[model samples]
Target chain A: MTTPGRTTAEHTAADTLEGGPRRGRVRPGGRRGVPLPLLVPALAGLAFLLLPLIALLVRAPWRDLPEQLTGGEVWQALRLSLLCATAATALSLVVGVPLAWLLARTEFPGRGLVRALVTLPLVLPPVVGGVALLLALGRNGVVGQWLDSWFGITLPFTTAGVVLAETFVAMPFLVISVEGTLRAADPRYEEAAQTLGASRFTAFRRVTLPLIAPGVAAGSVLAWARALGEFGATITFAGNFPGRTQTMPLAVYLALQNDPAAAIALSLVLLAVSIAVLAGLRDRWMTAS
Target chain B: MTRSARRTRRTLQVAGAGAAALLALSACSSSGSDSGSADSGSSASSASSSPELSGTVTVFAAASLKESFTTLGKEFEKDHPGTEVTFNFGGSDTLAASITSGAPADVFAAASAKTMKIVTDAGDASGTPATFVRNQLEIATLPGNPDKIASLKDLTKSGLKVVLCDKTVPCGAAAQTALEASGLKLTPVSYEQDVKSALTKVELKEADAAVVYRTDVQAAGDKVEGVDFPESAEAVNDYPIALLKDAPNADAAQAFITLVKSAEGQKVLAEAGFMKP
Candidate 1:
């Protein structure tokens, strides 16, 4: 599930670009240059994607928005969502970089199968993932029983469980992104460092680390977004409890059942946070890379 | 991309499409059954003189009505010969919301009067909804009642983990009413999203007990033990059914509703542990 200290190609892009001066001239194809066939569907797809969000805004109870967003339960769910998503992103970084490296840089038996399994969570329903987690890590779970008997720890229905569930669903994005960057990167730089008498660990730390930092950063952002929106697994594994395992998505769902206005308010907050994070990261990342 | 990378990417794309197609295919097949009965109306009027109801009837029902309603759907199909019944079972609140949002459902069956009111208030129901069944709460414990949870108050004991549905749903609201009527301020380990999830917690033995509908516990078989409590009498959730305003098959939909309220339908509901309305 985890590997550590792996570097990828996007890090080198970050490093080389950071040191070099900006030299590109502005080039614009312009919107009118787009052909009709592509333009039509592209605009339609944009509308398709944005229409529901636009409806959410249009139908949102703007009058009650202030009260709904300021509610204690709303804040509690928001805070917990941010906290767990960040933690899950951090955990994914710590483990996923290495797994990505193994997949990208190494030749092993069943490597294809291993890569498929690593990204299986991306395709599996989060509810099924939660059920699998319960069978593996719940109190009565196979390994969870041992954890309970020895460590007296129960993961389900706890804040930690929310983090674990998010990580399970979100880590694949990190791994896939980093591995793509790693495969694209030239391994000759690491070889060059090794020839200069640097150990494999030292080579990775010095040369590969700086080279793949951008991929790591981008992967982390992708994972954070995925984690932030996580619903099914978190609700299934951690259960919904305000100020505990009830994250923003769960709160939005339960709220939709009763107070739809509150649900819309919560959804808007989540949307705003996602937009803010992406906007903040794009400046630093697009410039660095 | 390298040859292997491109190949792997192709595999991922195919697998993703396969997964998506599987879901789409399942949805299509269920609705596809409707068209199969379109040409089967030859000599169909001779059997019961029930006004040769044909075509498909889409019924949006509460999750609690799954078993009994499914049985009724099959029986209705058998009686009508050329008629098909497709069911969309989910939380009554969600089903009501969908119907109000213009989902083309023939009939709507809700687990509670409150949820039924949502549809009725939206002017989606063609006529007055008739109450069909009532569901009472039961404390679902581990098999053999290992927690010894005898009453609503007993669930509050320390070291006991209990799960209940969230207050937004009917079961949860009933549980809240039952708890309050018993004068108990019990805090459960978690408030699950639905009755089935609450029952699942007890079934998995993660929680010592759960307050769920009696029918749910009965449906779960021997996985969990049901403990009847007197306070449950105060919070009986009434099930209601009505034909939709924009029903595609109004005749078939109304006939299906009649069958559900019939003696045979009542018997099926009773066998599933539902009480008389």
Candidate 2:
């Protein structure tokens, strides 16, 4: 009745009740489910969601599509988007891990308050974040003027500025995801490793890292994707120009403003690539199983 | 262990992709290529028989023409019994994109000839575009012209924070030409996304000055001082109005264009600080 694992079992039961069990339909040999209420809404939502892309396909000027896609600038923008997204993810991980650990493990006086503040970026509008970034890191910003004069480094309208903006909007996703995984995970592994000859940091790196690797990986992917499609912050903070700050999202937006067909095609390409990457990751899970 | 980590990473990627799709689906809007004027109430059809315009005529005018267009829009409504006139005003680039994307519109009035050509190039314009109004740039400085920015050259003072529109929009393109003509290499603090935003930086005291149109400066009156610069003459932007090829309300569109070229329309345009073409 008082088994040590009972609380963990109850916690998981609650998680299942709250919808975690149904996150994926992974049951083996289950009838090709007939959940009409959920299925119909899901299908209709997907179609409604894809209608614009469908319209883009229908109205796309196929003859001229080659010219648009063949542009070197398109690839340049695409490359920039991928590069900045990954870089931003890396930056977020470098700083966000400790922040997440502090929230998850270490107790401070304002720990609860601090946790809420760290997740602020998730709710804050991306444009507001861009403005805040500008106010804080712009040429004449409170701290940026020093950076400008002492370093001769202006962040606005530059590639680095794009990374900064993306990071500002994307880091919260990583923090929250990692924090959730940390809470779900068993910290006893760390204690066991510490009971051995290893120090706390060593135990963390060898034992803790392996145990929460799933969570860390999940957070990184979240951060990466958030950074990838970032538009408002990148455009507002970095400004749009070819071969510089014009990431795929900015190009897609500017294209959408003038040419809807081109916008759709670009969107489709982005979707396809992101799906491929995500699916490739999914396969890794299968292999792990 | 690493594999399980990778597996979770994969799940994270899927979630990220799912969120992106959600964002795209939510924000996606058609390239509204059609002007809003395409709507024709039954009464609007009477204009064809005897030019006796009766019902409503919707005009999708450019953002710069807000005051003048509003005044003229009201006057046109009064002149034509039961003739309602509505306006869909925004950046010319955005308006053109909307029109091209299938925004139902009759008459198209754009801030610059270039944006009008985007429609014309698509063969959407019924005929050749005519320059209806001309607008020149003005140095929108803070109240009292605190920067003492008398000429174009003075804007390069290194310390002054200036704002200009992005090159994709007509206002920004014109500003670039003005700067090039004056041989000034002044870099603005930022290339604002739109004309109003560029002017707003000055109004909010965020920037020392802004390069905006005369009409924009007038629109923002008292909040900022409009300083005349000779360089603006070299890059006057011509406003163009036309009837689209897919004009659902062609008669109303033509009638509205006629009213805009009328004397009353000129008075309205002048009152809003538009220069004579």
Candidate 3:
């Protein structure tokens, strides 16, 4: 108890090898032969994680699945869900990638603040984002009021509003994910490409983009998923009207209010579509990696 | 392959046994024959049958009834000692949807009979619904009527940015009925989600005028001036109240319903620019 560090050489040696020796028998950090301390906590974590999904699956009405799936409105919402999500993904790509590059590569004042500000949408509640959007772009919104009087262009209660709302919520995911990857990637490849008689734009378009294509693709998947599930912002900003602003999540939520079976059917459709796309992309990613 | 093989074999046997034990453990975790859950279920049923209620009663009512309902809710709490009353005030359709999906609400007061029917049609409502109040559409405009909007006909003038409730909502549905009856082909800049949102546009002076409930205009106080339209007679919305069938505290639900349809409730409704039902 009075020793400054350790008592014996054997004890010191044992202490040094304790982690390695214990891990050697079980494969370090692997699930095999997890210590009781780790095993108990890991199991508890898994149950906590899977409980909600399990509840949904257990409560899902399986008998009316076919009838509910056949409704045209279900298909309409699904179609709109896919179309808007994809459009939102494309829009995020167009705007977010360049913004990511600027945040990652360029030097400017408020760079730290700008980076924080760009991710503001990520933390801002989606409903609040809708209100902020209204204040800025709504008919009587700060910018929107002028646009309304000058151009008579109304964005609310339309398909365009749905797209805008989704984009507002989703673009941050694309920006943040891609920006992380850009910071991790080597910038020398881009510089070298530029030195090889290529313009900065060409270097970025041809070389840097191809190099980070996987990260961009991954980011797009995340963004698309976020867009697919977007609800509050879309409904608040766009207003829910059938065949116009009402997308799949909104329909599913509304259906859950009246007919839970229909909600399950819609959820299954969204899940199937998302899984299929993700699995296809994941296969390509695994092989390429 | 001598001592190492024997030790590995023993380890393997231990691991496989451990995994099998883990699988069994998980299976046991989710087994359905637990007396605890069953006991809780029976107790819940008993609680429903004869409640020992000592909790706050939450009501989700239409926003149009905000002023009067808040007053009534306070009065209700004062009458029922040791009982607190909370309200989640919003659109009728929204409140109905919240109720249907097991929102912990004791009473639902809706602006329209149609929205209440959505809940009753689903068999989510407990008993027969009674009309508690009625509301009629009125033209909301900027203070002093800068646009010179007088009648429903004037709202249809070209260059007037008339905001209306979307047809999906009851307020919007009423507006449509009024417009149809009047045969006025009025095109609005936006069809808002609810009455309050529609009136907000007019209140903010963004829209030239909006067709919102008289109660909404009344609720807005001096922010906007309301013009009583002749066509309002064609589109009077009936307000309905009912206790949900699956209400956790049926006693509280019934009591709240009684309070809503009472003579005291009529006074509150009338004070909020609503007609006595």
Candidate 4:
């Protein structure tokens, strides 16, 4: 389902890779014009993408906005969303970066297959991923049954479950982004450090880490944003409990059932936060390449 | 510029021709089905002696009605021959919200009068909704009842994970009413979006028990066990069915509703553990 979107993005990235410097040169001249065929549809596409967000702003209950935001439940959900998203990003960074490095830098059998499997969650529906997680980690699940009997640990319906579910769905963005960057970065720098008596791990720590910092930053932002907006998997795996697993999206969804105004108000907060983060970082890190 | 404009006009003409062909194909298929049903003999015709109700009837019903309503839908289709009955089942509040938001549905069956009122207040329902059946709350425990949960208070026992529908949904509101009537404050492990998911938590053994409709516990069939409690009497939900104001197939929608209110439909609902309205 998501393959077409990813392919289109890849094609766009390819176009940018070739068009960037040439477009820059053309900008200096300031003589050429955008073709009618492209400009008309481009404007239409921009409107189509932005109309919903604009509608959200237009229809928002502005009078009740202050009261809505001041509510304790709204703050609790927002705080949990931010906290869970950051923790999920950190978890993704810890394991995902090393996994990306291995995929990009090492030689292993069935590496292509392994990379494909790693990205399965990106295309698999989040709800299905949640069910899979439940089957694998629920108290009566295969591994979970053992965990319950031996260690007395259960993952569902807890704060930790929210982080795990978010990590399951969000880690793929980080892996794909960092892996693409690692493939683009010159391995010769790490090779040089290795030749200078630094161990492989130290070489990665000192040399490659700084080199791919922008990519890591971009990836972390993407993962954090994805985690923050996660709805299906988080609700399915972690369940909706205030101050425990109920994040902003779950809160917004349940609120929409009876209170449309409150739902819209909560949605506006999430939208504002996401737009702020994305816009603030885009110029410095996201577009660095 | 002229060449591009010509190409664009040509593209539009092609699209227009394609849409015309699609419309023609649909018209042909509908008529084809009509003729085919006419040829199926006197039984189908006699059963539907009243004005022929054809086309598809898209019913937006509450999740608790899934089992019985599905059986009723099949019976309706059989009786009407050329008609198809399609159902969209979910939380009643969700269904009402979608209907009010202009989702193209023909019939609306909500689990409670409160949810039905959401549609009627929005003027999305064509007329007053009729109560078809009622469902009582039941405690759904895992098969074999390992926890020995006999009453509502047993669910409040520590270390026991219980799931309930979100209070915004009908089942959850009813469960809340029942809990309040019993003077118990029970916090579930999770508040599921709907009754089915709450029951699923127990069926999967993730939670020790769930408060769901008796019909759902019956529908689960040995996956979970149903335990009746007296507080359920205070929270019995009345199911209501109505035709939508914008029903594309209002005739068929009306017939479907009539069938639901008919004795045959009542039989199916009773078989599924629903009570008389």
lDDT per residue (tens digit) for residues B17-136 in model 3: 778889998778756435435534554565588654334567889988888888987887777765567889987887887777778677888888888998898788888888988899
Give lDDT tens digits, candidate 4, residues B98-198.
Answer: 99889989899999999999999999999789999999999999999999999999999998999999998889999999999999999999999888888
| DockQ of the candidate models in sequence | 0.32, 0.13, 0.14, 0.45
Q: Local error of candidate 3 at B201, Å?
A: 4.3
Error of 3 at A5 (Å): 51
Compute the interface RMSD for each candidate structure.
Answer: 10.0, 10.2, 6.7, 5.9
Per-residue accuracy of model 3 over A1-289 as CA lDDT, tens digit each: 2256665655534544553244245432233345444555677799998797778778777787787788888888888888989999999999999999999989999899999988898999998888777778877788887877899887876788888899999998999989998999999999998788899899889987887888898889899999999987886777666678779888876665435577787888888888898899878873584
Better of 1 and 2 by lDDT: 1
**Which residue runs does candidate 1 get wrong by more than 4 Å?**
A1-32, B1-50
Colliding pairs, model 3: none
lDDT of 1 at B55: 75
Per-candidate Cα RMSD to the true structure, in Å, reads: 11.0, 11.4, 9.8, 8.6
Judge candidate 2 at residue B164 and give its lDDT.
Answer: 82
User: Taking the tens digit of each residue's C-alpha lDDT, what string does model 4 give over A109-208?
Assistant: 9999999999999999998888888999999998999998999999999999999999999999999999999999999999999999999999999999
What lDDT score goes with residue B122 in model 4? 95
Which 10-residue window of candidate 3 chain B scores lowest in summed lDDT?
B32-41
In angstroms, the error of model 3 at A195 is 6.3
